[model samples]
Target: MIKMRNVTKYYPNHSEPALAEINVDVEKGEFIFLVGPSGSGKTTFIRLLLREILPTTGEIYVAGIDVLHLRPWKVPYLRRNIGCVFQDFKLLPNKTAEENVAFALEVLGRSQHVIREQVPEILKLVGLESQGHKFPSELSGGEQQRISIARALVNHPPILLADEPTGNLDPATSLELMALFDRINKMGTTVLVATHNREMVDSMRKRVIALENGRIVRDQVRGVYGYED
Candidate 1:
């Protein structure tokens, strides 16, 4: 669940807000797509949810926590409730797939027993059960992305935010990745993806939130990608 009310974000010394008068509500267990052109505030939207940057004006709530007012020291606690995936597949080059996923829990000070139990199960959930021993360089782009997804989900965060998750892959690979996302959503994680892939958006037909000039232009259920390429 994410809610934003009259949210606007302005960068320092900038004449315009990166996001303006944005209001959105994402219920638990929903899969949604955020589609917009470059500079349209998709990244800004994600950053706001993650509390990576504070909004200049308005309110934000994720999973019932008031994000805007959350203390800096409490940010980590907020992050623990949300999983994030990025386009770069930010895997450690030297670590195996299992290690990368396990490291997330390890950083949170999870016990070795818990790490061992959760890592393999998450890898299997992401269709990487056998590839856990492989290094990032040894895996295909899709496989590496799957590893990233496994890492994100190992904690079973209630919300998953992915920004341009398929930007680096081929069409088939993108489809595969989307299917994986769908599977994750089915398991009760709220999914929000910010992407530019028109065909992917159209085919998936999920909730579509279109942004332009830092404002929400359209919010539709089962919507196609409506902008021209």
Candidate 2:
């Protein structure tokens, strides 16, 4: 689960905050969508959860760890519990799909045997079993993104955070990716996606949280991407 109360973040020399007076609580195994236009604090929200930046005033607890007071050396431990996917695929060009996923586990010092077992299974889970031998450049946009998702999920993180994950794909591919995300959520991983994809959000009809001017304007259990901007 995740909790944030009265959270506010401000950068130096900025007249306004990047995030302000935010309050959110996400339960385990839930699928949530954060819908907003650019500069609406969506990225800031994700960064805060990752402890990439501290809120100027507030409390944040993710997966039961007090992120604010968490020690520098323990940041990695907190990140281990959360999987993240970004707009860009961010794959290693030199590594094949299988190797790309294996690298994540390798960072945790997982044994070669474990990596071998996990890499193939994750590729299969992402519907890229045969493509494992291919490099990122050899794969299509969707496949590359799926590999990124596979890398993020290979460790079985309890929480998944995706920021504009479908920004680059075509509609068909985006829907396919969203379907994969839905399946992952059903498998018990809490999924929080920040995107402005109105069509996708309306179709999913999951919990929707809207942000604008760094403040949450709406929280609907079953909501759509209703903002026109």
Candidate 3:
């Protein structure tokens, strides 16, 4: 669950705010899309969630932890409960797909035995079991993205944040990726995806929170993509 109340973000020396008065409440098992045009503060919203940037004003609580007041030492622990995916596949080029996912667990100090067992299961979950030995350059865009997803979810984080996840893919591949996210959501993970794909948004009929000019213009259950294209 995540909550943001009257949150505003202002960059230093900027005359205008990047995010203005954002207030959102997401339930534990909800799947929501954050849709908007470029520069609409979708990425800012996610950075706030990840604690990559702090809010200039207002409060943000993620999974009942006060993100605004979180200690620097505790930030890593907070992130352990959440997973994130981005448009660019951030995999290490030298590592194979399974190694990439397992690396996430290894960073958390998980045992090698545990890493070996869990990594394959997660790779399979993301439909990339056979691609485990492949390097990043060897896989297609979609496959590489799935590897990233596997890395993010291998920890079984209760929440997942994806920013422009399908941005670089073709329409058909984008749909397939969206279906993967849907399946992940159905397995009880809270999913928040920030994207600009109107067709996919309309077809999914999921909860949508639309932002424009740094403000939420619409919050609808089973919402269509309502903004002018």
For model 1, how does the per-residue alpha-carbon lDDT over 1-229 read when each residue is reduced to its tens digit?
Answer: 8999999999999999999999999999999999999999999999999999999999999998999889999999999999999999999999999999999999999999999899989988988899999999999999999999999999999999999999999999999999999999999999999999998999998999999999999999999889997
- Tell me how many clashing residue pairs each candidate has: 0, 0, 0
**Residue pairs clashing, model 3:** none
Worst 10 residues of 3 by lDDT: 220-229
Candidate 2 residue 165 Cα shift, in angstroms, is: 0.3
TM-score of 3: 0.98
Residue 177 local lDDT, model 1: 95
Reference-based TM-score of each model? 0.98, 0.99, 0.98
lDDT of 3 by residue, 1-229 (tens): 9999999999899888989999999999999999999999999999999999999999999988899889999999999989989999788999988889999999999999999899999889988888899899999999999999999999999999999999888899999999999999999999999999998899999999998889999999999888787
Error of 1 at 112 (Å): 1.1
What is residue 126's positional error in candidate 2, in angstroms?
0.7
| Candidate 2 lDDT | 0.96
lDDT of 2 by residue, 107-191 (tens): 9999999998999998999999999999999999999999999999999999999999999999999999999999999999999
Q: Model 2, stretches more than 4 Å misplaced?
A: none
The lowest-lDDT stretch of 10 consecutive residues in candidate 1 is 119-128
Pairs that collide, model 2: none
Candidate 1 global CA lDDT score: 0.95
